[model samples]
Target chain A: MNRRAFLATTAAGAAVAAFPAILKAQGGDTIKVGFPGPTTGPFGALAKDQQQGASVAMEEINAKGGILGRRLEILFRDDQLKPAVGAQRTKELIENERCEFIVGGLAAHVQMAINEQTKKAGKLFISVSQSDEITARPDWGPLTFHEALNPTITSRAVGNWLAQNLGKKWWILYADYAWGKQNNAVLTEVLKRQGGVLLGSTPYPLGNPEFSAHLPKILAAKPEVLVTMTPGADNIAFLKQAISFGMKKEMKIAQPLHWLPQLKEGGPDLYADIYAGINFSWQLEDAIPEAKNYVALYRKKHNEPPGDYSAYAYSAIHEVARGITLAKVVNSDAVASALIANPVYNHYKGKQWWRACDHKAFQDLWIVKGRERSKMKGEWDFVDIVQKVAASEELDRSCKEKGFV
Target chain B: MAELTLATLAAQAFTGLVLGMILVLLAIGLSLIFGLMTVVNFAHGSLYMLGAYLGFFLIGYTKSFWLALVVAPLLVGALGFGIERFLVRPLYGRSIDDPLLLTFGLSLVMVETVRLIWGKIGLTLDPPRELAGAVNLGFTYFPLYRLFVIGVTVVVLVALFVFLEKTNVGLIIRAGSRDPLMVKALGFDLGRVWLLVFGIGTALAGLAGILAGPMRGVYAEMGVTIIIESFVVVVVGGMGSLVGAIVAGIAIGEVVSLTTLFAPKFAEIMVFIVMALVLLVRPSGLFGESGLME
Candidate 1:
């Protein structure tokens, strides 16, 4: 080929590479949403599910001709579950990608870091992780919207339910972290209200492999019910060690968000008869038609049932799309106003409405019990929901009393 | 406190035996490498993880757990051979810090590679049907697979001991550990012995991984946590002392198991505290030679 033709081809390729940037620079036509979370660490599975949920929502929205006729684009960056990385990635998303809104924060610390930036930038930030009432507090920022149920609400509901149904005496084993401390406080309040007494409480450092050291103290307490908030692989290790220590035979075990698929790694029989509180479950049929559809799609795509984090991300994206439509503009302030003012938005869990007091969305919580596969019909049918906790009852009074609004 | 009395102590002692078996498999390789070559194989845990994944894949493909159990270690040993010859040999005679740094970096690469291939979620490997359930120990129910691990490690340790004591290659290895210069002066190829020692050490790590695959779910980061505890075992037992490794492995295991009876939260810290006290008393380790400081 001649130099002229070659030069033309090279120039054409360069333009193709820079097309998206040029379009973005000319006018913010595309609505960009940033997903910053741990995509390659211990919590990578949770982060990946959240990202997938958001991706699915964006895909569905774009298929129907996106919000305000502009396609919604989601940019994912792995925060590695660190606050510093989350902050750095948030800044990059805002400055470089020029995202109009931000969504997805798997870790509590990451959410706090991103919240700091979003508050200053006046951008709408949707959190899909647990971080107690800190994120929901008005002092944190009006721009932040917690899509997931806060730990305070979750703990209170769990404690109250156990006290009323299971037993009045409780033994607590909590990770020594900010979320754990807040959860303990909330549980203590709820337990007191339900005429329950805290027998004993042991705090363990997060990711400690050996739980044998704390097992004796817990067993010695001899409470009717034992409650713990250690999540991830540590949960499996703790539960199995508890069984080895004969804690399972003595006292009933309760966990907040322990019925996840990660527990299956420990073994099918590890959490047998144990009760767990969860925000969402694929098994709940009457709750949302979208959940059933999500289960089917996720199974077809990944050959497995969609977990809570996946559903949360998927629903949060749809919610964000609704806000974008309401705003009708790709501006941060406009989107924030749309999210705040909007009420009774349709999510996978039927219709969810954000409580104005705490800026937390209200949804149904399920109490599930672990059962053996032989006792069940299918492979993923390990959990049987015992009760459905209504959204109104667990509205988190602390936020209301403190006037977070 | 009464719950953790003599009866509970006996129960935890059994639990410790199971845990120690796995640790011994891990520590033997670590001890052998340090003993013969004075090289700390930081990537030992990665090799163990690799063995588990290899065993999982092998079993899936071959439909034979026995084949996987045998083949995984060989594959790991081959890889160790390549690593020692190509990557590790050049760093010989250098500061001990170099191998530590190099192996640490190698571990990162191995972990990332595993993640890239298998993803971050852990995969389970079930034990053979004959050893799948728990065995009734009268006082406490023990997992059959864990018991199998203890049995396998005992057989392996005995075989290793006999080989080292009775075989010709074992004698050369022991002599080389004492003085490589003297062994080289005797017209024996110390280079080949070093290669074999490193390969066998890594192979033992792989064996531990395969045995543990059925217990601890095989994941990329499986090595990170296990490696730290293994180091503590090595330190407590005396670096490079095979007998020390065995005693320290079981001792640490018992400490962890029994501590959970009284103070479950401090069980992890208690193991390290014990190591610190051991170090204060004997800096070279419980079994390490005082004159052989690297």
Candidate 2:
């Protein structure tokens, strides 16, 4: 063949190969959000709720003609609640699926994994998981944003509230894990600041069926209040066994995630009068009309009141959508810049904003007590909000001092 | 700590008995399988989980608890029989460790299969209407379903004891456990006896799972935790001794319950501690016979 013909053929093939990329860069009609969370594991229930909430929010956004008239499409991948899986999935979502933004993190470890990966990729990562001080700290990556309440903030708030309302003496029984340990440390510091004495503290292995060994030590200490950071079946089992052992009669129980419905599944009698800190509750109608509307809409659609994870996931999707609108572009860098620059958007909880220093979003935390079944109107009814603690009052400045932001 | 009160102690004791009863049901199948086959079926816990999921699905479909109670075990037993006939039968003359390793691998495969089929969300099965609520025992309120479990376990143990002691097939099986060569020499089909023993053993594990489904959430990894404790029970009970399994199972259960009353954190580790102590005191186990297999 002639040299001219050969050159022309080669040029045509190269142009065909690069055409798709050029079209993609010009801006597609669809805005894709990547979600990686524990869809199957011990926290699988929470993952399911998160998926539902995100889907609902996406539907709402699409119904309103989506962001900048582009349909919002969420491509969710299961991280399996492992840090390694989280990192791998984040890489795949960004490099392969070409997702414009990323959302959802069920566990703190997974969140940290995604944070590192998204930072490297220079993409926005809005975390739904609780890891106390990632967002408001200057040391944190610029691309990260958090929608959930910080563990340190929530724990300190609960501890201070307990010291003031319940008693001065406190005992801590936490799961022997990173989140549990950190939460206990923060609570201890906050309680001491509030003029409360830390009588004793014990860490139990995750998924240990019997808490009998720790119960005796706790009973011996006989502190006025007991704070537990247990979640899932572990929390349910602890509460049931605690009631049977008569620990409830001696000391008031405070769980950070106690308002979760899993506690009620152990039986209403066991969880009765137990205090827990939550970001939002279906019973918080008097606090925020949007929360009330959220509960009604959630129930109307799912036949149940929205849990913490669900509400967070729903709010995250809406927040991301708003950011996309503000940026007027689906590119990751543009949307991220808009999210960082914008003030707190009114979420389901209330007016909330991401702290630029650490990227943590500060919001109201509610203290709820489990009520007796006789007082409850239905199966899902268990907790009643006792107090609505404001974000500004509850947030600790130590996060800044500790260089968490 | 303050002086322990009698009322509290009594309540703990009652709780212990209830806990022990569940352990007894879980350990019986493992004990029986070990005795007859000289094979420590590590997949026993997987069988239990299968039973629970099967019962959950069956009960949901039929809306008849009785039907599920009967059918779930039978299905699990059949699966166990298949495993024994195809996988286990070939490795019979190999080192004892071979079966243990084989069963462990089988357990992982079974657990993963269940996860793929059912998803990882833990499922809760409701107790039947008659046994749903708690009963106040004057001093304390006890879950009625738990009490029912104790009663059912007692009945099963009694029936199992009678069958092992009185029935012809049970006698043949027991004799085979002592000398499989002698049984084969006598012109009896030893393979059939082995299969039956394996089937029955796996079915008992399934029965335990079905009973426990309502008490605890059924999930893919549900068997992982229970199997470890069950192994401790088997070792403490003296390997393959049925009576020893019962006694040790109940003892371990009580220890767990009472320990929770005093120290909730150490309750889990206490089982292993007791096993270590039992091994130190009686190397062959409480009822285990020395040099019985080798």
Candidate 3:
């Protein structure tokens, strides 16, 4: 007890004291950023794609010169699309790892939960997932930034475009969930404003394999457009059945969101006559040289063209880096204030601005049509841009107008 | 609400029947194994997932959807035989809990293995070109592939019924499920019967998987989507009753289909409600019997 026990007690104390020194040695004066996303669920593909985007940005930023003369480091964790896991990881990254800034959110509820955690900790959080509710609320925090396009804004943009081109009658086949319901409500409001009639709507369960029963009901409506609010497997199921039943030839499909993972899974046949409105596209590389440059860099690293989520995730990280460089400090307060004050910037697009009122970014909305298999140039190529609507004018009322302080 | 014509009702019924057939295949697969071995198959859905993934890769290599559809299920069946012989056979004389634990853990292993092999992203399986378009029935334009699903289910069901009722092996299985002790006393190897039944049941699940691949995007968690629904089908139909599964599958399918015409929001929930109501009335299930699978 007096000899061996005393020596063992001293060893335990030394290891505890050495832990922080070990972390410092490994990190090496780097600005550690945390990334949390669904890495193994149904939505894992998009999560990996988005994470790749952020990773590439980190590598590039460090290659030249990182923020405050230090290399940028990223700590990645998988949330598995669970809100509780996301919130827990956010706190760990902020409290334990001393992450100065964190980005990446996949599911809407996960982002909402993490927003609360990040706000309380006063750490900067950028969400790459679609969740309008996350950016706008009475208690909107200065530290929270939303990178992905809002659900309502994108849906409205698609609706307005659909009304002009595909007649004024619409039918909806959507999944019955919070995200799907949000899409449906926004699309309904937009179509009403545009003087289009809601012919009928059907909401199926999440991950439902069969859509044959509902397809006949949708077709019977004789609507000019079939708007689907489901994504991933359900999206593929609905479209495949729709095409099989000859619904594609009868009416145009208005998909409110464009996820590259699902597109690749469904093949380009899905995009044959489908319509959607999204903020970023790898195809946008054709219009903007910077976009092409980013795509080339991402492809070189990932061996695949970055999807919309990937491109957004990449841009969001660089946005934080640029903010840190401008602030000349690694503190969260400095980065947040610098970003809010100077919102206009050019990266993947010509010029996009992050609105101060809601922290929502305004950029060009690319309206796209499904590129035919014959017309597609490469494997990743899927959609053809129909129009590029200015985000400011085309988007619906901002969060500020919607009564968020 | 729009007017519902006779034509519309017929089309909905036809569509519901197609859904019912897929459910039937899955339900029967679950019911047969339970009947033969008295071992609840938690990994059956995982087996089904393997079938789809195998079919997807086979198509890629062979460039023949037809060959993949035919071969994947047989390969899965052979795998099922091995799983029962090595993993499941050892636990037969032990507590029933042992097999259940093995299967539940085995399912996790299988799901993760597929995730690693295929990655987390979904893989597409294009339907045969001949079945891609619509078939005009004058009443309504129906998807040809969906029609094909219904056709395959009927042929499979008929083959299954003939095997279970007409053949000597089917008689032995029926007798064995009825009384394992009695069949063993009669000089039959109950061990061999259990293996065959487990293999055949899983192969049926594999067939359903291959059939569903074109419709449902082939992904790692595709098994998860159908496992619960099949369990519900098994429970609602009766624990080990083949006919009960067929009837319950169609009943649940039509309930969901017809509900879509009125309240699509409650379609999934409604199936559960119906199951709850049925259980309240029939404590043992529609055709469940005391010591049925003993």
Candidate 4:
């Protein structure tokens, strides 16, 4: 065929392929939400947990005669934990899948890329990843909402607890990345304010396989507390190597966040005695009625307790459904306004609210320690909640600081 | 700055030595495959990862690390033998890229299969009880398991050296790598030699994997990260040279470990920098037989 005929036939084929999807969207019986996650790579398990949580939420929502009388559907895409891939996935969700809203990002940097795409597409994005930049200054928009706790809150909560309880001498072992550096800085500030001495700080490249060389320096410094900011696979590798070197016996280990899935996988031997800040834990079911119900519901479908990221995704989907329910419309601005007007909602844990200033969710952050192997009640019972930092405006960046004043 | 005393330096060097040994195990396999067939075995890391997984399951079933160590490599070697026979044999006379690309695809399939079977979370394995804790050296406390890894590697390398340098089969294999046509002319089965060499190469990877499990946890994507570093070791050591693999692996390991002590941020980059500098000095690598153009 000639060039003109070839181009015309290809366009015709594309239009014919898109016709069925257009027909499907016109049915209006289901509401579509794009959920992009790092479904492959080191963080794959964590992302799988988030997808599992989304599955439970979808089931419950659809069971309740659906959101606004329409069945709720989540379209899952793998972002591969890459910023560019995340942007492309978000674009596909909006333009191709016709998802009205987007949710889920496991990595902090990748979430920003998703947010940028959502902003351009004028879609409501409920981010499940924790990044200070996602809700502050240049990136925050009317439709950008963050459900996960940022590094600031996590660092302050865990740092204060460690400084007051663990010891005065501190050493920070952090991954060299935007999120890791931000956590290190916040924790340092928190420690300094508590009259703690900074012994030393070591920043290793992300995905670094070994930590033994750095341990000698840490041991030599003899810091009372060793705070690590390694995430996902890096975290597992670091802790395993450090434990082999007997670093745990010498100093208290701590981190901004403890991934429950990792704790379950590593078991008590590797994770036990390491204190960390967390967004939510199933152990909260003891105190909160909603948490109990949520855990029970999740346990029926999955063998293990819902992870911290699972909680974020569960809350994001539920809150968005609630917003759509309140507004009785699928429009982004209307639902966003409805969500802002009604800030407080209880889905899994105690009360959590989306702050009106920057659409950043303010929720209780807990400090937890891994349970000893012998003390464990069940397979999933890996942590014991030590303290709960109540949700408060004081814990979040000020509205003025977020450039919203 | 944290004070780096003599003790600290000694401990860091030991750490480097341990890491280098692991690289040596991984790179030797890669070098052997390339030396024989001129096909870069991109799936070498996958074999290593599979070995770790097999070791994990074997230990769970048999409750013995020693048995798993022996059986896991054998299992991976068998798999490597099948891959060479079925997947790589047909592409023997084609462009080197044919088998290279095939192995790369094989790596992806193997990783996905692992994820399907084992799930995505990392699984930890403690070293044998005898090698669990740290040893109080004069300088600093070092993990006994790491010391054991170095010792085991030394013994394995020594045995490998003797076999390759002394035995008739080893001589035949070496001659085959140098000139397969001449080895065939002598009535030797070149195909079987190639298959055996590939199996041996992959078995080394499996052995390294099991050894690495206790130090770095086993997961599906564990192979992805280590593959690049192993490639660096193979290239810097001279693509097909066994001695080059050993020397370059240990040197790169020491560079990474020591750099972490003095300049933590430059540790990962230093490995590549060393490779670049070596290539600039010798385009065909340290012990390569032919120039790049040839």
TM-score of chain B of 4: 0.98
**Chain B TM-score for all candidates, comma-separated:** 0.97, 0.96, 0.96, 0.98
What are the per-residue Cα lDDT tens digits for candidate 3 across B1-294?
446888888888888887788789889988999877878888988888888999998999999999998999999899989989999998887776788889989989998999788887777788888888898988789988888998899999999899999999999999998889999999999889988998898898888888888887687788886788888888898999999899999888898888887888888888899899988999668987755544
Q: Which stretches of candidate 1 lie over 4 Å from their true place?
A: A1-27, A63-65, A136-139, A166-173, A180-205, A208-226, A237-253, A258-274, A286-305, A324-342, A374-382, A393-397, A400-405
Predicted complex 2: CAPRI docking category: incorrect
* Best model per TM-score: 3
Residue A127 C-alpha lDDT in model 2 = 90
Per-residue lDDT of candidate 2, residues A38-153 (tens digit): 98778877887788888878887898898897888898999999999999999999998888689988878788888888989898888997885455443267778888877777
User: Lowest lDDT 10-mer window, candidate 3 chain A?
Assistant: A393-402
Sort every candidate by DockQ, greatest first: 3, 4, 1, 2
Candidate 4 Cα outliers beyond 4 Å, as residue runs: A1-34, A55-101, A301-303, A324-330, B90-95, B177-189, B288-293
What is the docking quality class of candidate 1? acceptable
Candidates in order: C-alpha RMSD to true structure: 4.2, 5.1, 4.2, 6.1
Pairing residues by index, what is the TM-score of model 4? Answer: 0.89
Each model's DockQ score: 0.24, 0.22, 0.59, 0.55
> What digit string (tens of lDDT, one per residue) describes model 1 on residues B1-294?
334455456667777777777788899899999888888899999999999999989999999999999999999999999989999999999998898889989999999998888877777677788876565666655667777888899999999999899999999999999889999999999989989989998999999999877765577777888888898998889888999999999998888877666566677799899999999999988998876654
Point out the worst 10-residue segment of candidate 4 chain B by lDDT: B285-294
Tens digit of per-residue lDDT, candidate 4, span A1-405? 999999999999999999989978765678999999999877887899899999889999999899878999999999999999999999999998889999999878899899999999899999997889889889888899999999888898788889999998999999998889999999989989999999988899887767887988788888999999998788888988998888989999999988887887778988899899988888888899988887888889997678888988998999889999999998788889999999889899888988888988989988999788999998888888999888887776788987887
Least lDDT summed over 10 consecutive residues: which range in candidate 2 chain B? B1-10
Worst 10 residues of 1 chain A by lDDT: A208-217
Shares of reference contacts reproduced by the candidates, in order, are 0.22, 0.14, 0.74, 0.79
Clashing residue pair totals per candidate (backbone < 3 A): 10, 30, 1, 0
